[model samples]
Target chain A: MGGVITGVDLLATAVFAVSGALAAAEERNDILGFILFGTITGIGGGTLRDLLLGADSVFWLYQNEYLWVCLGASLATWFLAPQFNSLQKLLLWADAVGMALFSVLGAVKAIQLGAPAVVAIGMGVMSATFGSLIRDTFLNRTPVLLAPEIYVTAAMVGAVSYTLLAFFEVVEAIALPLAILFGFGLRACAIIFDLRLPKYGDGR
Target chain B: MGGVITGVDLLATAVFAVSGALAAAEERNDILGFILFGTITGIGGGTLRDLLLGADSVFWLYQNEYLWVCLGASLATWFLAPQFNSLQKLLLWADAVGMALFSVLGAVKAIQLGAPAVVAIGMGVMSATFGSLIRDTFLNRTPVLLAPEIYVTAAMVGAVSYTLLAFFEVVEAIALPLAILFGFGLRACAIIFDLRLPKYGDGR
Candidate 1:
């Protein structure tokens, strides 16, 4: 179970790293900026999650693979961003995948760490959203979480679904995939359909 | 020693919470936003410091006093913002004091947690600045840390000062006041004189 989850986590990290690199490219930052943004975006969410959960050490500090993955993806994007058309949409979809995976993974970890159900869900949403939040803040842009989007909602659904499934005695193998699908499906739909939640003053 | 340090910590938290409330008032956000911003800004730095140092839990979560202090300050600000002309400058000085105290305290805690000197210094800077980082991020403004100020430099100097003093067997009674004075003094001078570090692209 750990092996499977670790594989998914790395994939998510890579996707978010690419998104971060692309954001840096859009800002016309140099190689150092690319690496910094990528690494932060890749690991920022999990780092916050681990910290909030009182983990002994951050995941990347304990194991170097996450750092390497972020750097590798950053370097790759530094060379590829100029040639890529439609970078924005690509970033959105990739970010959606990362968000889905991280949300479920964070919730699982929090539950294992003895967090209450609601706290686990909140951690899940935070883990899914905070990396992008950091990236956007660094770029001096409004974070996607602050925007009215299906992003955080998808993470909540993923977390809640996984928690409910676990409560029903479902195996990890079955629960993880279903939760990922539920979150990814919602986020993908949002991207495809330009879905948005109503603004507070919109009178909808 | 612990008693004195805790007093300084709570004072800083109250000051920062007021600043946070003022920031929310500037944005015309409602009561909920004021409370949320106040609470996060008040404790955000120490939370980051503990996480970076791999502490068991955040300070506010371990003890409830910090939360209450933040809440009290926020509530006060909610009722007082309109009549409190000149909030901006007041926030600046209060925040300067906060930066000073948190920087030294964070460094001390990191060293006590067995981190090396350089890492401790970095944590010190993080603890001083990250609360404002969070506040500015939420409010969609660039953070002071990235604004080419003498702010982070002051925090660094304080951390280094305290660490060296402790290394030389200086008692906390002597060291803590000196460190805080060092940081706060530098920051106050910067604010008074409109001091700034040389910008990267200034071509000077």
Candidate 2:
């Protein structure tokens, strides 16, 4: 069970790492910048969550595989940049998958650690989105999560769903997959339809 | 002994919270933005350090006094802005003092946790500047630490000085004040003389 969870975690981390490296490439940053962005983005969200949850150490520090995976993904992205024509779409899909996986993972961890439901959901959203926030800040762009998109909303919905399932004593195996699916499906639809939640605009 | 250290910590948190609130006010952000930025800036650097050092939880999260101090500072800034003509100068000095105090505190904590000197110094630098980094990112400006200012350099120098003193068996009473003095003095000079390190300009 732990091995399967770790597998999903590493997969999400690798995907986010690639997204971060691609962002660095788009910004015309150098090699060091690519690696820095990739490593930070891959672990940023989980690090914040662990810190908030009072975990002794961050996950990546204890798990060498996560760091190596991020490095490999970054190097691959850097080397393949010229041929990668659909960078934006690729980033979107990769980020969506990462968001889904991490949200479920974060919520599960927070709940197990005895956080209230609301706090657990908040952790899930933070875990899903903060890496991208850091990436955007480093690249001198507004964070996409702060945009009027269905991004964070998708994560929140999934976290709530997971929490409800757990409250009803659903097995971890069933709850986890369904949570990821719901989050990913919402995000994919948002991408396909360009969906966005309403925002407070300038008064007409 | 612990009382004095806690006092200094709370003082630094309050001062940085004021700086963050002032920034939000300058940007004409809402009340929530003022509080949010204030709380984040006050705790951001320390949070990063504790996470890196594998602390069970963030310091502010464990101590409610820190959060209350931040909130009070932000509220004071919000109400006092109209009458405060020396906001910029005030911000500079408060920030310098806060940077000095946080650098020493972060270094001390990391050292106590058995981190190497280099890692302790890095934590010091991170603690002194990361709050402002977050503040600048949110306000859509470049972080001062990223500029060729004497800012992060001051913290690094102080951290190194403190580590060497501690390693040499100097008492905390003597080492702490000297470290803070070195950091604050350098930052004050930088502010007074507009001193900055040379930039990597595209030389002709």
Each model's DockQ score: 0.17, 0.15
Assess candidate 2 and give its TM-score to the true structure: 0.61
| Candidate with the greatest DockQ versus the true structure | 1
Q: State the displacement of the C-alpha of residue B112, model 1, in Å, after optimal TM-score superposition.
A: 12
Instruction: Candidate 2: give the clashing pairs.
Output: none
Clashing pairs in 1: none
Query: Model 1 segments beyond 4 Å from truth?
Result: A30-32, A79-83, A201-204, B1-43, B52-54, B59-130, B142-204
Quality of candidate 1 docking, DockQ: 0.17
The sequence of per-residue lDDT tens digits that candidate 1 reaches over residues A75-173 is: 999998778787777777778888999989888987887766766676677788778878887897766555445676787788888888878879999
List model 2 lDDT by residue over B72-189, tens digit each: 8988887776576766677777788888989888888888888899988988888998888887786676666775558988888778888888899898889989988998889888
Q: Pick out the ten consecutive residues of candidate 1 chain B with the lowest summed lDDT.
A: B27-36
Scoring only the A-chain of each prediction against the true A-chain gives TM-scores of 0.95, 0.93
Q: Give the interface RMSD values of the models in order.
A: 5.1, 5.6
How accurate locally is residue B55 in candidate 2, as Cα lDDT from 0 to 100? 71
lDDT of 1 by residue, B1-204 (tens): 779888988988988888887776666555545665787788888887776676677766446688779878988887776666776777777788888988998888888888888888888888898988888777786666675558988999889998889889899999999998999999888888878888778886
Q: Model 2's CAPRI class?
A: incorrect
